[model samples]
Target chain A: MAAPESGDGNNGAARMVTLISSDNTRFEVEAAAASLSQTLQLTILDGGGGGGDGIPLPNVDSATLSKVLEYCIKHAPAAANGGAPNATAVDRAELERFDNEFVNIDQSVLYSLIMAAHNLEIEGLQSLVAKKVADMIKGKSPMEIRRTLGFPDPTPEEQAEMNAHMLEYGWAYE
Target chain B: MSGTIGVTLEQSRSRTAGPVLPENHVVSEILVRLSAKALLRCRAVCHSWHRRTSEAAFLLVHHRRQPSLPLVTFLAAASSSQSQHSHASLDTLDLRLPPLIGVGWTPLPRLADAALYLHGSSGECHILRCKRRRYGDHGLTTNAPAYHVLTIGSSAEPRRIELASNAPRASTWWFRCSERPGILLHGCLHWALHSSPEKLLMVFDTVTESFRSMPSPITGTQERTQLLEMDNTLAISWMDMCETTMRLWLLQDYETGVWTLSRRIIFPVTEMRSVLNVKWCRFYGTVVSQERYVLLHDSHSSYLFHCDGEGKLVRKFCWSGAVPRPAGHIGSQRASSGMSSSEGNMVLVRGDNHVSFKASRV
Candidate 1:
């Protein structure tokens, strides 16, 4: 499908594309925004996702796809500017604030977002979510981390091994 | 919390029940963002985390991802009047914390009898200390230097490594082991030895705990030079005392020891005079942060200049009269010298004075 030139004439109209999520939810977004995902960039560049067929994302659910698109749309302009060397300080700060707020979601949503971002090959989203997870893991003990990550109670043998490790690395606890 | 002690928590309680565990690659990504100490603590999380974190591949990835904050460890005499007894201390200017007030100075346990001097540290925070054997009433029976490597907070005792017989010995006052910190790269720590008529690079492989020497990139130059690690490769930077020119050479091929002259920078006469009023001064340069900036400090003065790779001045900082100098120390001879860390942080060590500057990108 050939992308129809935007009618604005100066820079052409913003080209829009349709993305179909796994659960059959359809999200219409700007082509530039959807192209932020390296996986989708190729298909979009090949003139896919421009028509009624819409690009299908089998690995990502509707909710996760929407969340990922929100990030791509917010970051697309800066990405298009080749890292936005000319971006104003306010512009950069706004994006940073947007990013921090974007990841402030439940752990379950964050996990799905991480998986979707990875499958879609969205570099910024992957890094943001990974850092969030790291923050949650920092400072917590192994048992706390196990609980936070939702691990089952340790078996007696596993508990014995953990106790031995704690004895060996007692300084870390201090 | 007591009621929950023996209860088996189901996966559904976890905020996300998609999978019991994240993929190994995802876990590695998260692990890389953690600090070294935090990562060590995480080793007890599970057997899988322990095995993954211990892999050499994961270490390299973590080193690359984490910012290299320059930390300075030095020995300070117990008192200004008494130079005999000293204690070791470490301080780091962590930028992740708030500016100016984030200095962490921890006094390390004192080494018994012998004076311990900091030689260098690896990116993994493995510190190498040289125990200078002091002669008492017994008189000098053995003068060989003793070396030890230990990580901070590690329960394992520091292990001593025997220096090879062929290792260059410091014989003269002027040629005391180069004040520069060891350059850690490629699983080895490298130090430049200033031997008369020839300067040799001494390398210690952290893996094998063996010592070997390699020829300096530029030989037979009377100019002062320092060895530094840049972009995972060994680099040497030297200043021409006669002229205001600095030459940087990088060992492009470690296996072949082939050095390519990467950059030749000429300092402006005015900028040079601002740092040093004298006509001739010894300056040592180290490439900081992806070869973008080179940090140069005058041997005799506390003034430090941060310049671009091309030798243009970006900014200048001076410790000047405020820096506590050991009494009777002559010339611009500093007890310790400054080194650039992986992320462009400048670490300056002299006697008890340890200062680190967060890299200001120009």
Candidate 2:
């Protein structure tokens, strides 16, 4: 129980920390869950974001912050157990399934998730999103990769250059 | 390639807290996660990407971040009117997974005679020479190789590692490593040497660059024994002559050489009662685990079964690459050696997490 130092050990709400997103939206979450982010862990550990004062995340929008909080909440228990090696296969499969579904989002939202994960220093979220993006790159031509990953369609000049590069470096193409 | 594609991207770009592929740090992080082939193709994306991904520093980081994938290589001896072993080639079976797909592979260095087999894992390569009567004349089979060469990517000269003089005659015994390469675990390469009355595992410490031996506690006249890295500890999977059953033994303590019978993997096979009820089946012995189930993949039989920790058959996949030579290979490699009917010498690199070979040549 991460009750704030200010709490007299009776206030039930003392276990929660409030986070303020860039859009000025306030989100109250368990200190254990919020501590999943290394960026927020210190503040949570120091009893900094309790009660009236909330940790400010100026770089994360409200939409992304909510998503990040959802992930942190889901994974906090496993992280608290120090990656619980004794976790049953069913539990691990459940977490893996959760991880697989978490990243199945719009490309735009995926990029946002990566940035949020990176900025908040969430290693699990960072790797999950990176793996998702890596899957899109495999077995696809450069043009197809750009198209699939939501990159702006290359102009004719850029397309010509890419073709030329492929021709020049045989290993770069299939 | 339409308005729908970059619509969200455009909206995200308007916000202050967003990243695109242009962000070198973010992009580099994603690039390093790609498979070896996909990473190569990424160079064609642009001149800048080629320049950035080609840097030695980036490669070092990629190698470190490299999710160890199972690499399967097939030796295709180019059929010629001359000699069978003279004109041959070895290339990796490029099957990237998590979805179990892929099409092509870049050919590895072409060996003139199919004498040397290269087994690489976690960036270290062990060049093993197959046992042949020809090597005995050169005083090779008589003496073991005493060098562990270290060559950092693209370095001209490789630093020769000094192996101890007591390094037993490992060439003939290690050649059997063709079926099972030396498993690298806890900063050492382990090879189970089943030579004589005494069976021991040869451990080559990467840090110390020296050799040490650990005697195995479990003994079997069965011949199929491989050192596996199970959950980070040393484990050996051994099957009897019947070939229908396998016993997995876990080393409880590295210091005391204690062994524990972990699980029994009963392969789903119909054993024929040969002559005097001495049951027999073709060879099938290699264990690779998934997150939930342990999949024992027989490289020779080309049949893979996903079994529980108790080794109960949960599901199975028929992966006999009986279709055709996988895409990107130069010629066909027929399965020979007077054993079972093998299409090619199928070898999967050790400790691969994303290895899921389905009904495709992928």
Candidate 3:
């Protein structure tokens, strides 16, 4: 495990905030980075999550919280530029590449990230995760989808329905 | 990242009979991103997915996002073991979408045998298939082959009604009814009662699974009238290429059945003609876009002319012998060129034993 840093004083005296995950793990992150979450933006605006009182995020676990923070930190610079209207194509492409890599984790961790992203009201993250999931299931056959999403073997009635569905839309079966 | 990267070991997709990934947020978010074909496949996953995708509000939202791309329908003949007589089936090749992407054809295997005419979309693809050894001399149905309406991917099979074999008047319809390809408009497949302008337009309403006649336009149909959908309205283009002029009429308001002569296109005789005495093949077809850009190509598909709504020539796009096989990829190239037209069109390139065409509303 990599040692956790006190954010390494990268910004000298920039405002830092602490977040407490559901498991009571405290994470210290830059205020601007944490503000990417609409849920946290307001509390951070009122000078909250400063000094000792960390924002309590009961819906997110430490792992998901760390993942979300990493994304926020990476994206905060671009967001601070007001949707980066002046940002070069290379910069946007770099961010896109990072984002593609960020979501390339295990399925369980990915689902948890989606839930955490949703709870935090991070619109970009939610859409990114949703698109990833959509791409995974697109063009897949019913049985393949059932297995991919971990759906159990269909009961007799469900099997009949599946059969009927296959009969009707067999052209779509890939 | 290591400490809880192991979280997946206990609760990945391997975990069955537990909390599934999708909530309402995730389902709608994910489902909407899927294509129409993918969504239909996704509906078979489970009851929750099936019901969620089936919701009317969700369907409307999903449909709005779908690209109204045109499809190339090719009539391919194949022998079916289910029936003694060889039959022809309507197969559509996707113009834009991937995998098939104009190159491959998605044949309707279920509706393969004896399927003659393909029409009526939106709710379901109503396939009109004929059965029994009851074909007239000119490859037309002498009487009825027992009209079996196969509603693809929707409700129960509509009751089969054999258009009473004893009815002799039905025999006159042998040319138009059984042979001529039906034009789809407003959820109905329409056929002219007679080739003459005086006859009423017969519509086989796919929704009600019944037949009804819509009165001819107030100005009456023009000679050699061909139905095409333009800007979401039914249009007829009367092309007597021999006279080097075409008349176009649009149904402004369908409820009132008002027909307005929109354009009178006069084709230039000097350009685009066959080597021998200006002979035009049946393979040549026309399509009008929502922007009113009219496209007509030669029988060889060698030249494509784009004309304005007023029948004035705008530009011309041509390619080498595109398809003695199946032609559709030209559409993408056509888009890249100027005049970005918006209606879906396909051309029916006649092959050895098959025929294909591009038209409005597929």
Candidate 3 lDDT over residue span B1-362, tens digit each: 22222223122344375435644456777888787668778888776777777665565456445442322223322322333221122122222123331343443212122222234344433445444447667776555435566543445755574443333244344222212335555656655544443445655665566666665542222224555555556676666646466677787888887889887777554454542236554323344344544455544343445566665666654333232112111121111100101233221211111111112221
**Residue-level lDDT tens digits of model 2 in A116-160:** 888889999999988889888888998877666655566687689
Best model number under DockQ: 2
Give the per-residue lDDT of model 2 (tens digit) for B1-362.
11112223322343333234434466778898876557766776655566667654565466445443332333222432332221111122223132222233334322211111112344432222232343466565554443434332323443455445565555534424333445556656666776434567777665555567787755443246655666667788777777777778888988888889887767555422221133443544445432223444433333334456565666543332321211111101101011111222212221221111111110
Question: CA lDDT of B308 in candidate 2?
Answer: 61
Candidate 2 chain B lDDT trough over 10 residues, lowest sum: B331-340
lDDT of 1: 0.59
Candidate 3: deviation at residue A159, Å? Answer: 2.0
DockQ of each model against the real complex?
0.23, 0.34, 0.26
Backbone clashes for every candidate come to: 2, 1, 6
TM per candidate, chain B = 0.56, 0.57, 0.52
The full ranking of all candidates by DockQ, starting with the best, is: 2, 3, 1
Which lDDT tens digits does candidate 1 get at residues B225-328? 65666666777777776546778789988887788998888866466775577766556554444544555655445454567777798765544232111111
At residue B58, give the lDDT of candidate 2: 62
Q: Between 1 and 2, whose lDDT is larger?
A: 1
By summed lDDT, which 10 consecutive residues of candidate 3 chain B come out lowest?
B332-341
lDDT (0-100) at residue A78 of candidate 2? Answer: 78
